[model samples]
Target: MTGHVTKPGRALRRLLAPLAAHAILIAATAVMLLPLAWMVSTSLKQSGIGLSRGIEWLPWRDAWTNGKETVDVMVLGARVAPGDGGEAVEVGIKSLASRRRFTTVYVPEGAFEAEIEAWRIRPLTGEDETAEARWAPFASVRRRVAPEWGNYREALEKMRFWVCLANTLAITFLGTAGTILSCSLVAYGFARFRFPGNNVLFLVLLSSMMLPSVVTMIPVYLLFRELHWIDTLLPLFAPAWFSVNAFAVFLFRQYYMTLPFDLDDAAQIDGCSALGTYWRVLLPLSRPVMATVGIFCFTHYWLDFMGPLIYLNTSEKFTLALGLYTFKGAYTTQWHYLMAATLAVSLPCIVLFFAGQRFFVRGVVMSGLKA
Candidate 1:
């Protein structure tokens, strides 16, 4: 009886453990996604109302319907006024200070408009300057979800998004290809060949990763200037071809070391040269590492802002990251448009990660296993 009771208790505890863990993971995911949700919400909202005091998850706006047409409006205030019959409800764009002075149009006491007359407010156009005050009944106005989908269209147009996207794509593709080719070659040498000072040379290469890019920024800029590569995409992607990414080389080398040396011998027996063996046998087998490095390089080149800012001068040469900066003026920013553009710019990276997630995880796990 005691053993059976304890077995059920243990089973219950096992079930609850995964449940608790899943609950925690779900909560954490929601927390991490909050900022992205807010960005989407802001992107859909009307310009002036997006940053309201209250937290609104949906894009809502105040809308009013006149007799012929309906239009969005801002509510001002309401007041009592002398009607033809007697004192009745009055609502208008007139301010409280000037309410008594402005001419009022009173609605009948029994009218539906009179029931909501107290809720009326000023239109977005501001105080009525006309001799007669302009107002709408509160019953005619309502809070409705009206997302400004046009913000994205307007943002793309203003930011020259297509041109910037093209430039970013060019740089990302070229740079990712260069990183993979160059880093793999270096990593192959370190993994396969026997040479004097090989370990020391690799240590020196790895040490470069510890040095901050800020230390070399000025010197690199001067070198690019000397080469007349300033204001061009060459400065952005050319260095990638030289296997400058030590971490990438390290990942490749580790993954290569996991492969058997017999493969190299087999390739040699089949009349394949060292370079040919790497190209056919080793590289073709390194899909996981390649995917991992490609995604990393793609993300880096796609979002690189400082490189483009320092090297490229013309607007046409701007990457998406730098192009987004154009939305902020010296005085004020268009927050809705900025949010829309940001969401648009971030979608590709998000999609790419999800698409290559399996390979990325496998690459990271397998790379460290042997080394």
Candidate 2:
């Protein structure tokens, strides 16, 4: 009955379904990307731009259009000039009333259409009158891109950026390595070894994920303090070595179970010990899951704020997340520099995810299907 629809109806459904899906996806993508784009925009803008009404999507635009800079504009207000039709007068442009719209050019003779083409903008360096060009009035707009690369430099100056960046990279590498190795080991044991209380222990481990990090944060801090590990990266890196992450263990366990037990048996028959089997047989085959776990651990370590803030007192030991807070002061906040620093910090994660996205997704899907 359903297949008995008209050809036009069927075609319409096929067309509409994909269109709707794409529309929704595009909207979701825009929702995510707009803020990042805006951050880039804000970071590139020259500082001291207070809270404005409209959004500045692009950082660089001409003075007349974006109302950002002042230029000597020649307006064509009741003028019978010699050569062409454009006003050439130097006026200090200021966007006072409307930030979203164009600058209010105070025309000396009160011209109505005070637009770009009607006005001959002065050269930025005030050398030559290059405004009288091949432009036939009201033509294509010439856009000038002024990328403020200095924002990144200034942002680095706001905090101990190099030190923090180095610390973050070190912690991320060590932490991810430890997480993958420890989790894989624990997961192999749980997946292969038929030990007593294995199921109960697994259940307990899974349940640990439900508990908030805030619940255990103080106790862990106190323990680390007693061990004199305060203000050290050890406080962050030590736990990964012990496979304290329940979700990572669970993910690894699920992935490991997906592998054929026959492989292990075959390895054992070849005089390979359990450790040998894990090292040679399983480890080689578990690249996807390893990548997944590594990505997770890397992301967590990179974005960790509370952990670093609580443990590290000295600015020298601060992570990127901790160092970023320095941009905020009692009276003012450096939004441009903050955004620039954030973009710089987020770049590594973005690159890593894009590079290993396929592996990460496949690992997740395969783990779910098997267990």
Top candidate, metric lDDT:
1
Candidate 2 scores a C-alpha RMSD against the true structure in Å of 8.5
Model 1: lDDT of residue 167:
94
Q: Write the per-residue lDDT of candidate 2 for residues 105-149, one digit (tens) a residue.
A: 332221323443323333232222454232212122223456667
TM-scores for every predicted model: 0.79, 0.73
Model 1, TM vs. native: 0.79
lDDT of each: 0.79, 0.71
- Give the clashing residue pairs of candidate 1, or none: 75-121, 75-122, 76-121, 76-122, 77-121
Model 1: per-residue Cα lDDT over 176-287, one tens digit each: 9999999999999999999998999999988897899999999999999999999889999999999999989998998899999999999999999999999999999998
Give per-model CA RMSD: 7.0, 8.5
